[model samples]
Every structure is written in structure tokens, then in C-alpha cells.
Target chain A: LAKTTQPISMDSYEGQEVNITCSHNNIATNDYITWYQQFPSQGPRFIIQGYKTKVTNEVASLFIPADRKSSTLSLPRVSLSDTAVYYCLVGDPYNNNDMRFGAGTRLTVKP
Target chain B: SAVISQKPSRDICQRGTSLTIQCQVDSQVTMMFWYRQQPGQSLTLIATANQGSEATYESGFVIDKFPISRPNLTFSTLTVSNMSPEDSSIYLCSVEGTDYGYTFGSGTRLTVV
Candidate 1:
């Protein structure tokens, strides 16, 4: 399992783009970068995932560098409802049993 | 995608008592997982529920304290034995999808007083 480091908290205004970066210096070649969003009292929701370069979804986008050491989750036009904890995980998809989540970065979308 | 549901969305139990949280998925899944989230803290993986076999627990968690049962692929239960104030937390059940993403239940909030 690879350990990830991210900011404890971040604040952004509504309608602005928010980017949360995660550092996983020990990421493995077989590992893929995934991001999850968790709201209060709800389970973590899958936002976006990518192995390398950029992957975009309706909800968010994931950008992974060639080195695979770090990835960034970009949420465009944030809203108050987007305020939640964001977790970045790196692991092999085949071995789902060992996936783990870190402390996560709490993003507060201010009005 | 799988739809997961948990019973007893919230419960208040006295110390030394036990509460069983149930998880049911709409479709059969290969792996089911249990997790705990303490207040103001991140999620912690408790164990992996295996069908027709014993569950694999994580470090700091024991089968005696958090017993998990998986009779089939779509259903599982986690029992918190002899609860204490320290046992108060949100217990969530999850299953990994074919896409390698996790789908989780709403979570059962247990309050031990």
C-alpha cells in the first residue's frame, strides 16, 4: 500500500476551480491514481480515476504526471454542495482488498 | 454500479451492549469490506468479509470485537461486541465494483454511552 500526503483543509469560493493535489512518492508502476469524494454522513463517492495523463468525467477531472508520484483532482465551477473531503488513493485495481484511504483534504466551498 | 443498504441507520446503545449492522447489496459482489470512521477522523478499514469463509481483519481490529459474517455475495453483517464509548463511530460497508471502484452503504451510526 502506498501512503498519500495532502493538505488538511482548503477554502475556495463558489464558481471557482478547485484543485487538490496528493503526493504518493512511493507509487508503484502497477498502481493507478483514484480519487473519492465524501460528504457528511455519506459514504465516499468515486469521482475520477486515471493511470496517467488526464481523464475527465462529468463530475471532476484527474491529472497524473508521467512520474506517477502525484496526481491532482480538479473540480470545475465549485458549488457549496461540492464542499467535502477529497481522498487520493494509489493501488492496483486487481487487488481491491488492500485499498486504503488517507486523512483526506477537506474542501470548503464558500459563498 | 451496486446499490448498498445498511440497517439501523442510527442507534443509541448502552455500554456493554451489542449492535449488529447489516449490509445488503443489489448485486452479488466478490469482496465486501467494513470500515470505521471516528469523529473528525478519516476512515479505517476493519476487515474483508469473505463468502463462506472467515473474514480477514486489519491491524488493531479483532474478530472478537468486530465480528463479520458473509453468508453470500450480496449480504454481510458486522457486530460490535461489548460496546464502549470508544466504540462510538460510523460503521460503513462497501463492495468493490468491476471498475475497481468502491460502492458503500449509507453507514450505521452507533453511539455507545
Candidate 2:
């Protein structure tokens, strides 16, 4: 399992874009970068996932560099409802059932 | 996406007593995982529940203290034995599918007093 590091908290205004970066220096070649959003008292929701380059979805986008040591999750036009704790995980989703979660980045979208 | 329904969404248990949390998935899954999350902290994997077999627990967790059972592919249970105030946390069950990323139950909030 690869350990990830992310900001403890971030503040963003509504309608602005927010980017949370995660560092996984020990990421493996077979590992995939996944981001999950967790609201208060709810399970974490899958936001986006990518192996490399950029992958965009209806909710967010994931950008991974060639080195695979780090990845960034970009949320466009944020709103108050989007405020939540975002986790970045890097691992082989198939083989590694033991997923380790970091402290996560708490994004606060304000008005 | 798979829907996981966990029982006893929230419970207040007395110290030294035990509580069993149940997780039922809508579809069959190869693996089911139990996790514990302390308030304002990250998730900690408790064990992996395998169908018709014993569960593999993590380093800090043990079967005697946190027993697990997976009678079938779609159902599992985790029992917190000898509960204490330190055991107060949100217990979550999760499953992964080929198409779906990962689905987690709403979680069981246990408070020991």
C-alpha cells in the first residue's frame, strides 16, 4: 500500500475552481489514482479515477504526471454543497483490497 | 453500483457488552471490508470478509476482539467484543465491483459508555 499526503484543509469560494494535490512518492506502476469525496456522517463517494494523463468525469477531473508520484483532483465551479473531505488513494484496485486512507484534504466551499 | 444496507445505524452500548453490525449488499461481491473511523480521523481497515471462510484482520485488530463472519457473498457481520469507550467509532462496510468503483454503507455509529 502506498501512503498519500494531502493538505489538511483548503478554502474556496463558490463559483471558483479548487485543486487538491496528493503526493504518493512510493506509488507503484500498477497503481491507479482514485479520489473520493466524503460528506459529514456519510460514506465517501467516488469522484474520479485515473492511471495517467487526465481523466474527466461529470463531477471532477484527475491529473496524473508521468512519474506517477502525485495526482491532482480539480473541481470546477464549486458550491457550498461541494464542501467535504476529499481523499486521494493510490493502489492496485484489484489486488490490494487493503486500502489505506490518508487524513484527507478538507475543502470548504464558501459563498 | 452496489447498495449496501447496514443494520443498527446508530447505537449506544454499555461498556463490556458487545454489538454485532450487519452488512448486506444488493449484489454478490468477491470481497467485503470492514473499517473503523474515529471522529475527525481517517478510516482504518478492520478486516476482509471472505465468503464461507474466516476474515483476515489488520495489525491492530483481532478476531477475538473484533470477530467477523461472512456466511455468503452478499452478507457479513462484525462483532465488537468487550466494548469500551475507546471502541466508539463509525463502523463501515464496503464492497467493490468490476464496473463500480467502491460502495460503502452509511455506517454504524457506536458509542460505548
Candidate 3:
């Protein structure tokens, strides 16, 4: 199992870009990086997933380098509603059943 | 994205009692996952449920304490048996999406007093 490390919390202003990075030095060959957003009293929702380079979605973008040791989740324009816990997970797509969640970065978007 | 409906959104149970939480997915999935989140903590994987087979629990979680049943491809249940205050947490059901990520149920907030 690959363990991920990220910041405990972050602060961002509305309309500004927010980047959350996660480091997983033990990432495997087939492992992919995924980010999830979770609000209070609710289950997490998928944000973006990427294997290499960059993958963009309507909500967020995930950037991974060649080494794949770490990745960053970039939110284009954060808002108040975007304030939530963001989890970065590294796992093999084929066997993602064992993926564990670490204490995610608590992002607070200010006006 | 698949939608998941979880039953008993919130329940307050007495100690030593058991609470069974149900999850129903609109579409069929190969694997269903259960997770627990304690107060001011992160999510922890409890088990993975596959249809017509025994659930695979994570380390520190036992079937006797957190039994899971996946009767079909689209529905599964997780029972927290002999509940204690330590077991009071938010239980969530999730299904891996066909393409990239996983979809999660609304979540069940369980409080054992």
C-alpha cells in the first residue's frame, strides 16, 4: 500500500487558483492518482484522476510528472462552496479496492 | 456517474445494539466498498463487497464486528454489530465507476450511545 502525504490545511481566495499537492514516493508502476472532494456530513465526490502529464475536468485538473512520485490538484477558480477536504489517493486502477484515505487537506476558500 | 441511495441517513442506537445500513446503486457494479469516518478524522476502508462472495475486510476490521453482505451487483449492506461509542461514525457505501473514479452513497451517520 502506498501512503500519501499532503498539507493539513490551506487557504485560498475566491477567483484565485488553488493547488494542492500530494507526495507518494512509494507509488507503483500501475498506480494512478485520484482526487476527491468531501464536504461536512457527506461522502466524498470524485474530482479528477490522472496517470501522467495532466488531466482536466470541469471541476479540477490533476497534474503528474514523469516520475509520478507526486501530483497536484489544481482548481481553476475556487469559490466558497469549494471549501472542503480534498483527498489525494494513489492506487492501481486494476486493484483499487485497497485504496486508503489519509487526512486530507482542509481547503478554506475566502471571499 | 452512478447514483447511490443509502438507507437510514442518521440513526442513534443504544450500545450493544447493531445497525444495518443499506446501499442501492442505480447501475450494476463489480465491486462495492464500505468506509468509516470518525469525528475529526479521515475515511477508513472497512471492506470490499463483491456479489455472491464473502467480503474482504481491511486490517483491524473483522467480519464478526463489521459484517457485510452483497447479495447482488447493485445492492449491499453493512452491519456494525455490537455497537459501542467507538463505533459511532459516518459509514459510507461506494461503487467504482466504470471509467475513472468511484461514486459514493449519501452516507449514514451512526451514533451509538
Candidate 4:
């Protein structure tokens, strides 16, 4: 199982672009980086996933470099409601069943 | 994409009692995962429920304490047996989505007093 490490918490103001990075030193060849957003008292929602390069959805964008040892999740013009815990998971969900979650970063967007 | 409906959204149970949480998926999935989240902490994987087979538990988790049942592909149940105050946490169920990510249920907030 591949383990991920990210910051415990982050502070950002409204309308600012926030970037949260996760480092997976032992990432596998078939592992894909996936990011999930979780609100209080609710389940996690899938934000974006990428195997390599960059992947952008309406909600967020995932950037992965050539080394694939780390990935970043970028939130553009974050709002107060966007404040939540963001989890970075590294695994091959297509072929593996051991999908584990890291400590995650708690992003607090202030006014 | 799949939708999961988990029942008994929040419950307060007495100690030494068992609570069975049910999860029903809108579509069939190969595996259903169960997770636990303590207060102010991250999520922890409990076990993987596979249909017609024994559930695979992670380290520090045992089947005797958390018995899982997967009678079919669309539904599964997890019973937290002989609950204690330490077992009070948010229990969630998840399934791998057709997309690259996984879909999780809203979770069951269990409080054992």
C-alpha cells in the first residue's frame, strides 16, 4: 500500500487560489492520485483524479509531475463554503482493493 | 457512478450492545468498503466486504468485533459488536465508481454511551 503525506491544515482567504500538495515517496507504477473533499458530518466527495500531467474538472484541478512521487490539488477562487478537509489518496483503484486515506489537509477559507 | 443509501444515520446505543448499519448501492459493485473516523481525526479502513466470501479486515481490526455481511453485490451490513465508548465514531461505506474515484455514503454517526 502506498502512503501519502500532506499538511495538517491550511489557511486561505476568500477568492484566493489555494494549492495543497501531497507527497508519496513510494508511489507505484500503476498508482493514480485522487483527491476527495469532505464536509462536516458528511461523506467525502470525489474532486479530481489524475494518472499523470494535469487533470481539470469543474470543481478542482489535479497536477502531477513526471516523477509521480507527488501531486497537487488546486482550488481556484475559493469561497468560504469551500472550506473542508481534502484527502489525497494514492492507489490503483481499478485493480486493487486496498484503498486507504491519508491524514488529509483541513483547508479553512476565511472571509 | 453509484449512489449509496445508508440507514440509521445517527444512533445512540448503550455499551455492550451491537448496531448493524446497512448500505444499499444503486448499482452492483465488486467490493464495498467500510471505514471509521474518530472525532477530529482522519478516516481509517476497517474492512473490505466482498460478495459471497469472507470480508478482508485490516490490521488492528478483527472480524469478531466488526462482523460484515455481503449477501449480494448491491447491499451489505456491518455490525459493531459489543460496542464500547471507544467505538463511538462515524462509520461510512464506499464503493468504487465507474469513474476514476470512489463514491462514499453519508455515514452513520454511532454514539455508544
Candidate 5:
């Protein structure tokens, strides 16, 4: 399992683009960077995942560098509803046992 | 993606009592994961429930404290034994979807008094 490091909290205004960066210096060859969003009292929802380069989805986008040591999750046009905790995890997709979460970055989308 | 339905959405129990949380999935999955989330904290994987064998627990969690039962591929149960104030948290069940992404339940909030 790879350990991830991210900011403890971030503040952004509505309609702005928010980018949360995560560092996983010890990422393994088979590791993939995944991001999740969690609202109060709700389970975390999958946002985006990427191995390298960039991957985009209907909800968010993930960008990974060549080193695969770090990744970023970009949320476009933030809203108050998007204010939640974002978790960055790195693990082998095939191994469910290694799905561990790090201290997530709490993004506060203020009006 | 698989849809999960967890029962007892929220419960208030006395210390030393037990509460069982049930997880039912719409589809058959090879494995289901149980997680615990403390207040303002990230999730902690408690155990992996397999169809026909014992669950594999993570460090700091024990079967005696959190007994799990996986009778089939679509359903499982987690019993929090002898609850304490610390046991009050959100317990969620998750399964890996066909895309290898996790689909989580709404979670059961347990409040021990």
C-alpha cells in the first residue's frame, strides 16, 4: 500500500476551480491514484482515477505526472454543495485489501 | 456500479450493548469491505468479508469485537460487540464495482450512550 499526503484543508469561492494535490512518493508500479469525495454523514463517492497523465470524468478530473509520485484532482466551477472532504488514495486496483485512505483535504466552497 | 442497502441507518445504544449492521448488495460480489469512520476522520478498513471463509481483519480490529458473517455473495453482517463511546461512528460497507472502483453504502451511524 502506498501512503498519500495532502493538505488538511482548502478554501475556495463558488464558481471557482479547485485543485487538490496529493503526494505519494513511494507509489508502486501497479499503483493507481484515485480520489473520492465525502459529504457530511455520507459515504465517500468516487471522483476520478488515473495512473499517469490525465483522466477526466463527468464529475472531476485527475492529473498525474510522469514520476507518478503525485496527482491532482481538479473540480471545475465549484459550488457550495461541493464543499466536502477529498481523499487521495494510491493502491493496486486488483487488490481490494490495500484500499486505505489517508487524512483527506477538506475543501470548503464558500459563497 | 453495485447498489448497496444498509439497515439501521442510525441507532442509539447503551454501552455494553451490541448492534448488528446488515449490508445487502444488488449484485453478487466476490468480496465486501467494512469500514469505520470516526468523527472528522478518514475511513478505516475493518475487515474484508469473503463468501465462504472467515473475514480478514485489519490491525487494531478483532473478530471478537467486530464479528462478521458473509453467508453468500450478496449479503453480510457486522455485529459490534460490547459497544463503547469510542464505538460510536459511521460504519459503512463497500464493494468493488466492475470498473474496480468502490461503491459504498450510505453507512449506519451508531451512537453509544
Candidate 6:
């Protein structure tokens, strides 16, 4: 399993753009980067996933650098409801069982 | 995506007692995962349940403490035995979806008093 490092917390205001970056220096060639969002008292939901380059969705955009060691999740026009914990996970297609979720980055959206 | 249904959404149990959580998926899945999330914390993988075989548990988790059973492709159960206050957390079940993602259950909030 690839170890990921991310900020413990982040703060943003409504309508502002929030970008959360994650680092996984030991990412394998077959590993994919995925992001999940978790609201209070709920399970984590898939936001976006990418193998490399950039992938955009209605929820968020994932930006993977050329080095593939780091990725960023961009949430445009944030809202108070977006306040939650965000997790960056390195997933292996062949070995998904070993994936782990670390202490996610708590995003606090203020009015 | 696979829709998961878990029973006994929340419960308050005695420290010496045990609680069983049931997860039923809408579709047949080969592997189902069990997870534990402490208050204000991230999720920890407890075990992986596959049909026709014993579950593969993660480190720090044991078969006796957290017994898992996968009767078929769509249903699984997790029983937490000899509970303690530390076991007072949310227990969740998940299955990998065909969308290259995972679908998770709403989770069982267990409060061991």
C-alpha cells in the first residue's frame, strides 16, 4: 500500500475555491489516485479518481502532476455544506484490499 | 454502483456484550470489506470477507474479537465480541462497485457503555 501525506485541516469561505493537495511519493505504476468526501455521521463518498493528468467531475477536479507523486483536489465555489473531511487514497487495481484511509483533511467552510 | 443496506443502524450495548451488524448489497459482489471509524477519526479496515472462505483480517484486528461471515455474494455479517468502550464507534461495510469505486453502508453507530 502506498502511504499518503496530506494536511490535517483546511479552512475556506463560501464561494471560494478550495484546493487540497496530497503526496504519495511511493506510488506504484499501477496505482490510481482517488479522493473521497465524508460528511458528519456518514460514509465517505467518491469525489473523483485519476491515474494521471487531470480528471474533472461535477463534484471536484483531480490534478495529478507529471511526477505522479502528488495530486490535488480542487473544489470550485465552495459552500457551507461542503464542510467535511477529505481523504486522498492511492489505490491499486490489482490489490485494492490493502488500501487504507488515513486521518483525512478536515475542511471547514465558514460563511 | 452497489447499494448496501446495514441493519441495526445504532445501538447501545453493555461492555461485556456483543453486537452483530448485517450488510446486504443489492448486487452480488465478490469481496466485501468491514471498517471501523472512531469518533472524529478516519476509517480503519477490519477485514475482507469473501464467499466460501474465511475472512482476511487486518493487523490489530482478530477473528475472535471481530468475527465476519459472508454467506453469499450479497450478504455479510460482522459480530463484535466482548465489547469495550473503545469499541464505541461507527462500523461500516463496503463493496467495490463496477464503476471502479467503492460503495459504503451508512454505518452502525455502537456505543458500549
* Model 3 Cα lDDT, one tens digit per residue, A10-106: 9999999999999999988888888999999889998888989999988888889999999999999899999999999888879754468988999
Candidate 4 chain B, run of 10 with poorest lDDT = B95-104
Native interface contacts kept by each candidate, as a fraction = 0.73, 0.65, 0.86, 0.84, 0.68, 0.62
* lDDT accuracy of residue A35 in candidate 3: 93
Instruction: Candidate 6: list runs displaced more than 4 Å.
Output: none
RMSD list, candidates in order: 1.3, 1.2, 1.2, 1.1, 1.3, 1.3
**lDDT agreement of model 6 with the native:** 0.91
Model 3 clash pairs?
A: none
CA shift of A76, model 6, Å = 0.6
Q: CA shift at A23, candidate 4, in angstroms?
A: 0.1
Instruction: Note the DockQ of each predicted structure.
Output: 0.78, 0.75, 0.87, 0.89, 0.76, 0.76
Judged by lDDT, which candidate is best?
4
Per-candidate iRMS values, in order, are: 1.1, 1.1, 0.8, 0.6, 1.0, 0.9
TM-score of 2: 0.97
Supply the global lDDT for candidate 1. Answer: 0.90
Q: What is the lDDT of residue B42 in candidate 4?
A: 89
Off by over 4 Å in 1: B98-100
For model 3 the local lDDT of residue B2 reads 88
Model 1 agreement with the true structure over B56-95: per-residue lDDT tens digits: 9999999999999899989999999999999999999989
Clashing pairs in 2: none
Model 4 lDDT tens row, A2-81: 49999999999999999999999998898888999999999999899899999999988989999999999999999999
**In order, what lDDT does every prediction score?**
0.90, 0.91, 0.91, 0.94, 0.92, 0.91
Q: Lowest-scoring 10 consecutive residues by lDDT in candidate 3 chain A?
A: A90-99
Q: Report the lDDT of model 3 for residue A61.
A: 86
Name the better of 1 and 4 by DockQ. 4
Give stretches of model 3 more than 4 Å off.
Answer: none
What would the TM-scores of all predictions be?
0.97, 0.97, 0.96, 0.98, 0.97, 0.97
lDDT of 5 by residue, A37-62 (tens): 99999999888878899999888889
